[model samples]
Target chain A: MALTLDQRSASRRESRRPAGPRPVRGGQSPLARRQRRIFGPFLAIPLALYLVLFIGPTLYSIYAAFTNWDGINTPTWRGTDNFTALFDDPLFIESFWNTLLILVVVGIGIFVLAFSFMLLLRDMKGKGFVRGVIFLPHIVSPIVLAIFWGFLLRHDGLLNALIVKFGGEPVAWIGPDSAFLMIMIAMVWISTGFYVAILMAGVDRIPGYFYEDASLAGASAWQKLRHITLPLSWDVIGVAAVLWTISSVKVFEFIYAFGASQGQMPPAYEWNAAVFVYGVTFGGATPQYRFGYACASALVMLLLVTGMVALLRRAMRRDAVQF
Target chain B: MTRTGRLRRSISFAALGLSALLAVSACGSPSGPGDSAASGEFTYWSMWQEKEPQAQVIKAAIDSFTKDTGIKVDVQWHGREVMKKLTPSLRTKAAADLVDQSMNQLGNGLSNTGQSADLTSVYNLEVPGEGKKVSDVIPSKYVDYLKDKEGKPFMVPYEVTGEGLWFNAKQLPTEQPQTWDDLVKLLDAAKAKGVSPLALDADNTGVAKYWPLLTLIRAVGPEGMQKLASDRTGAAWDDPNVLDAVTRVEKLVKGGYFAPGYNSGQYPAQQNLWAQNKAAYILQGSWVTSETKTYAAQGFEYSSVQLPPINGGTDAVGVNFFGFGIPKTAANGEAAGKFIAYFLNKSRLEGISTKADNITPRADIPAPAALESLSKSFQEKAVYPSGAALGLKFGGWESTAFQPVAQSLVQGKTSAADFVSQVKAKSIEFWKTQG
Candidate 1:
């Protein structure tokens, strides 16, 4: 059947007589078959791993969320009880709110700082060195950064020590009201470098002539950015936003390591969704072992992230600038 | 189609199947050593790192245990996460024959799951090379405290930990306060003398609850505290005693008795301040001396005192035990029990006090000087498990509900009334999810 279709297509092509090269028979050439042979194993191995390692556990977790399992016993079905209970759970609500704040507030802080740096670095001397220096935090282990952040912000930490040395009263940098705010600021500082690199890559791809032309036309820096740089980097910005949304929900170790005291959880107020999940399950002086509840919380986070990313993509969608 | 094309297609199918098989096999649970009973050896998972002082003591005891019985033992130093890691292993044959962790951890990880073996027999087992049994060494009160809800012993205590107001003996009055008001007067005097009265790591939600819990336990009793924790409707916070306790904490907060930034900094920071003589007292576990010894003030002398009594209240002290448990599926339960008795021997257990700088269940063994006062309290006074071990059983009620409200109260962020109401609301909210 394929041979007959191929012959008919070849005869049609012969009638038109416009092609420079003939199509392969049945759309399977020797090179194509060889490529499939060589690449098929490479793709299949990771695909199998992803399905087994990621998808399998994800599906099991989703099932577990609807049950009452304490990570040791048989899970009994509880339908939507776990999900319904979550709304009334003050800890869960607070953590979810914290997660959202990190997504929106920290996200904005990171982007604003990153875009400003990207623009400034575009014309600066030793741009590479400055970029490298800014990117250093991104490459450093988050646990290490959290330790450094703690040392700088804690009540007798280096920052306060310096203030006292200079004849000033030591400020309560990590006071109850200010703890989460400091954490958000640290998140912004640690993440701005990565987004700067991404935006810079996108901005660098735009031809310099566009900016030169805009300059000739008496365009201000803001006007040039609005017309050229932003539109050109719109897709990259959308991706970065989505990345930050997902990562913000999973920001566990930094807050946990920095805020947690004596191997116990930080105060419930500082908890984001990831910390909430751990706090409810395996992460405390006395592990709660609330597997089903944690899985439900995790599922809620996943759904919220999925919806957020969908909305972000819809909002970011625009006609591509062909530049 | 050509020969190479068909050959390539076949190869691709083969590769896909091979990869799929590899993935499926990788998902299977790993098998451990065979039946320990037949081998006459037991697998023990320890809660301490091999290099830790506690582990070194336990290791020496294990070596002697093996030599005495001529029975081989396989021990793994699983560290502090042993209990958390032991949960999954309990479902499989990979589970250890013996495991050790705090009683609270055992209650949450083993007893609650019904995976802990009844340890009454172990308690009755005679200690090797010693005249007495395990129960003879450990006091009856602790043995009763270690029992499960079903009244079966599930853990054997080796080390004892008590929570109280830790202080530097050189800086603070050595005399224990007789009443809450008297303690307040003492704190005021200390403050007047230029030492901060109290140091708290409010960032640690777990430890932050110490002040309120102690006050509540003093105002009400341990049973009353348990009632407050287990109350699903949250009305227990309305108990006048709870309000009184909360008000006491508020007074301390308003009195400016806590160290500067006491409500904000991470742990050890505040505790370290207390160690450095900048603060007069820190409410902490008995381990505070060993934990802060490195940075302690140049002549710092560690000491502790139980919470001052309230009129018409029980004087039960809060105690936690570090002990050993046997899994229900353990093949070498008998041998594991023997080891427990052997380790409890006075000579062997002395290492916990002398070398590890901790208190032991055997009161006959002199406790580390810093813990001597607490050790006396543990033996002489009425004692109960801290928090009633309800923090784990009630779906993390302490961490989720009590801790945040207590933090707000102790930090002076919330009024006593507000603190009571918030705790009530949080308690109700917490129980709603437990359903």
Candidate 2:
């Protein structure tokens, strides 16, 4: 596979030809400068495409929020009316609180579970199979997962059938006990696989000597995990957490798929920030489309996500412990 | 510089110019989909998929209209994105000539936002063949529907259906309970038999608990309920009749009338139990028969009974119907109006009964075998404008009144009297905000 062309002498000529390593500035090379200037704008193609296609419509929709446009009528300026109403609206508040709670509780729970699994499976048999099995839900579409889950969670769905047979009462997976918990359960179940994979990848990278040396020094398994494994994997943990916070805030499909359980969205156990914005802005029930309020909700979610990632990153701060 | 350097510069300049031009073109067009119907096609959009049987029936209506008018209807069968995808055109008033939507939800959706046109004048249409007026063809079927008190028909009912409770006869019995006592007694019997008395998903909080709450309210007196909704203030979760309803529901829950884990149970299990011989009753509409036909295949015998009152709702259940209306943005209001009148005709409504397994609201239209017997019973006994009329058609009562009341009942939290109070409070609040 080796090409024997220049060896060391040809490289020296090429290096010397670059005008003693200075950039091809306008002073040095007019042609090179012209080429650089001309090619610069052409590189903006991808960004230009992204801005127009995704960001443009999104911005337009955000703008439409300030007005009362019901899909058919001309947008009438409502100013802060949508936001004012959203503040007073009990439903939005309920959803916001519930979503925030789910993010914190479920987020931590799934991470802990995945990390534990990473430790347990390290020296265990069938490690690859176990990892693959756990990650399967992460690979499946959220919509499909939610639909199937509805059957298990709905009042009369599979859960009730089993409960009735087992002399137990059925639980309302969609509605009463807590829609957030239901959503959290599904989210954790679905997301654990992804976190497990990340943790496992991190675990796999740990140097063998660190563990071998620890064992030779008679360091207990628990002490090695706490002192070495935990410290070494903090970088990966931080990255995983950054992913979780970013993803958790924008969650919609899983919650939506778990259907409102008949108006349990936002105001009841089922609602959160995303669902609140959804029902407020482009919902079927609300005659008044509060596009602006929805934008505000989205803005709030973005801030919360940013704040969380920053806080988590800061909290997980430690010097890199290279082996 | 050298000639070769100048030539390389020229080549580079040309390539760079070409790339910039390409990048500029690659920038988003900032325009939506093309107006496919601008090619002289009468575009009709409906909530239909190709595989649906209902699509075929609706297609027949479109086909019939095309045959009679010599117009080509380009119908786009959209399932979901029709609202989001078609929103731009709908807002810009470049919507379809005829759009398919349910009267209540879509009415509140499109027309409530002031998109659709009032069909009052259209109802004053002439008959297609007999030189008779359209009123003569369909009679007063849609006349009352085409206008609000302000004389604006925001949305019109396309299909007619009656709202009531549906139950499996094996558990609920064919002889529909006439009195509220009778209804409770039946539940008691089912409860004693170790079956769920009612198939109520409290979590849904929209229909199940609310129906009984309304039934109890009507029993106490519609006037008081109406006055309470108009009279009360915040959190009227403590009205006497409403309390009674709540107490009764709580009793039902404590007495094991509702399924255990009822809070978390799926809705279908309640009715499914009836199919599986586990449930006794479910509050539903006539559409349940058509909607639950598959139950028959699953060895379940399902039938519907009117929403009986606490003491035989002297007035009746409620009056909600599927409606038809022309969009204010219709390209040809005249043609669209003609289609509405033509299709909702006696023959057409009757034709719908033959095709789609639903009850026709037309007094003259004959019912099919499935609906024939029930239709006779409804005409003979079921009171009019009670069940469907209970909702706020012009005002906003559907979300506030019925759903909340039902949710309370399912949760076993509010009494019937309290439910009524809640309804009253919601009604008043709705009226205050209502335009």
Candidate 3:
């Protein structure tokens, strides 16, 4: 048989190719092939875990938000009633604002303080030791810290006892008027160390030569921080802000431990969204178990976190400064 | 691919398959209550912490039960956290065959939600070798408190509790205050002696409002408290009797009778203050002794009294209680029932009273001396359910409406009329959503 031009080319290409096994592009080498073999289920296991653990509960919660289920009874559909009721609820409104305040006010306080500490520690002696001490609260259980804080501020507690011993009248440091403020301050104390560590790591990655050059140029410390440090560490700050936003919304244990002496829940004035959700459900002297309503509150919190994170990403976005 | 590569891939695939199989197997079947007849073992969850005297007594009873019945029970002590865990656990296959917890441990107790077995049959069961039915031993009044909406007793009554004004025998008179005015004078006399006349668990939203609500319920009658909750018109709270109760409570708080920091003091802190005689009295439940036992001053003695009648209205008393229930999911329901019957038998309950420092629900068991003084008031002509007892309406009200307003009232941030108006408005809003 006479060979055509296409047949002649195919023969040429085939003869040029190495024999034994066919070559495949895009993750088809022997090692890649081995990886591929395990990859499906290696990926599958975690993906399945994520689906089952996180996504499944999230979806169920969303469905429950529209119903009228006490934790014990069969749920009944209540449509948007739970949402409508929540909007009208003063407690929910207070909790929402409280959450927002923690996110915005507390968030700002933490970032500024963290940045300053990071800058100070960047050039300071024995920075590692200082960091370990400051980060101690972060590593220690928040419940323990809160208990210590309470012991310090309680009526006959250490602080008040000291004041009285000094011939000063006892002050209600953790009274109703000042308790929320104390909580905010305690939160800042607890979380600032974590953020400082994150910010410091980001700042540390920048070459020390940049600061030397700035000093050579007579650029003030503030100017250097404003122009060089912040812009360079922008990505870490963005991530930190989003993390704080998410975590502050879920702030329960620290505040809840404050109420351990109070019974199932703290006073309403001290409650934030997380405590509110718990209070409406099982965390009360009498169990309300308003599961559907609590789900609605939780969904609102989820939306708040999602929205804040998205906004933070947008607001903090900048061109990557290649070092 | 190379032979080794192919072999590695096969091994990886096999490993992944094995892990997945192991994971699925690890999930296992949800554990049901054990077959007591076949395996001779059952499970129980107790709400009391093990160190508590009540837990010790129960443990002794369980030991007795095992020795007599030859059925082993596994008991888990979860304490106050039991309520948070009970509902979800009941839905699972790993549910315990029996649970010992507060009567109001679940939402309105096991009877309201039908979560536990209808223990009415347990009431008919004879206590082992005691020759008495459970009903014959436990008081009918206490049983009445345990009834569900269907008039069935879901809890086997254990500890009976009451809420009243408690005073230190060393500091204050144990005699009843003759009238509301006389009570004010007595409070003043205590103040003159450098002790605050009252202490409050005001930092607790649920507990802070108990004094005001219970007094109002008694002053206006149960019907009045019901109207305050149910009446959408908001006029129910405006009843003169309600106002009188609210005003007098306001006077007590505003009169500087309470400890200086009472409005802001946390639960059990104010209680401890009373224990140390910093305050002359505390409006507390029967468990106050156990709660403050550690804080007790040397030679400290406790006695309780009913609140004096307001405006010569009928004298009423407030009582709260705790007991135990068995979940409906229990596999060994018969064995669990027998255990409950044995636990509540008269002799066993008396031991509970003496050893646990509680008011056992069995009438045959006399109250300890600390509570004996208040027994007459508890048995008074008009029996009033404290807000705690009205679990259905009181829970949401205390959390949402009453406590916050009461906080303001005690702080002098809001007036009695404002308290009434706020409660009415909140009640209307609360009931509207409840439907």
On lDDT, the candidate that comes out on top is 1
Clashing pairs in 3: none
The weakest ten consecutive residues by lDDT in model 2 chain A span: A260-269
- Model 3's CAPRI class is acceptable
Give the TM-score, chain B only, in order for the candidates: 0.90, 0.74, 0.86
lDDT per residue for candidate 2 within A1-323, as digits (tens), equals: 65334445546655666445555532447876777867856777877798979899778766765766555556677776655555544455667777777778889889889978988999899999999999999899998998788877666578778987999866555665565577788889999989989888888899889999999999998999898898988899989989988888778888776655432332234667877666654544233344555676676667678798899989999999886
Model 3 C-alpha lDDT per residue in residues A36-135, reported as the tens digit of each score = 8799879989998999899998898999999988776678999999998898777888788888888888888888888878888998999999998888
Per-candidate Cα lDDT values, in order, are 0.85, 0.62, 0.77
Indicate the worst ten consecutive residues by lDDT in candidate 1 chain A.
Answer: A1-10
Q: Is the docking of candidate 1 incorrect, acceptable, medium or high quality?
A: medium
Q: How many pairs collide in each candidate, listed in order?
A: 0, 63, 0
Candidate 2 overall Cα lDDT vs. reference?
0.62
lDDT of 1 by residue, A57-132 (tens): 8999999999998897899999999998888888889999999999999999999999999999998999989998
Interface RMSD of each: 3.8, 8.2, 5.9
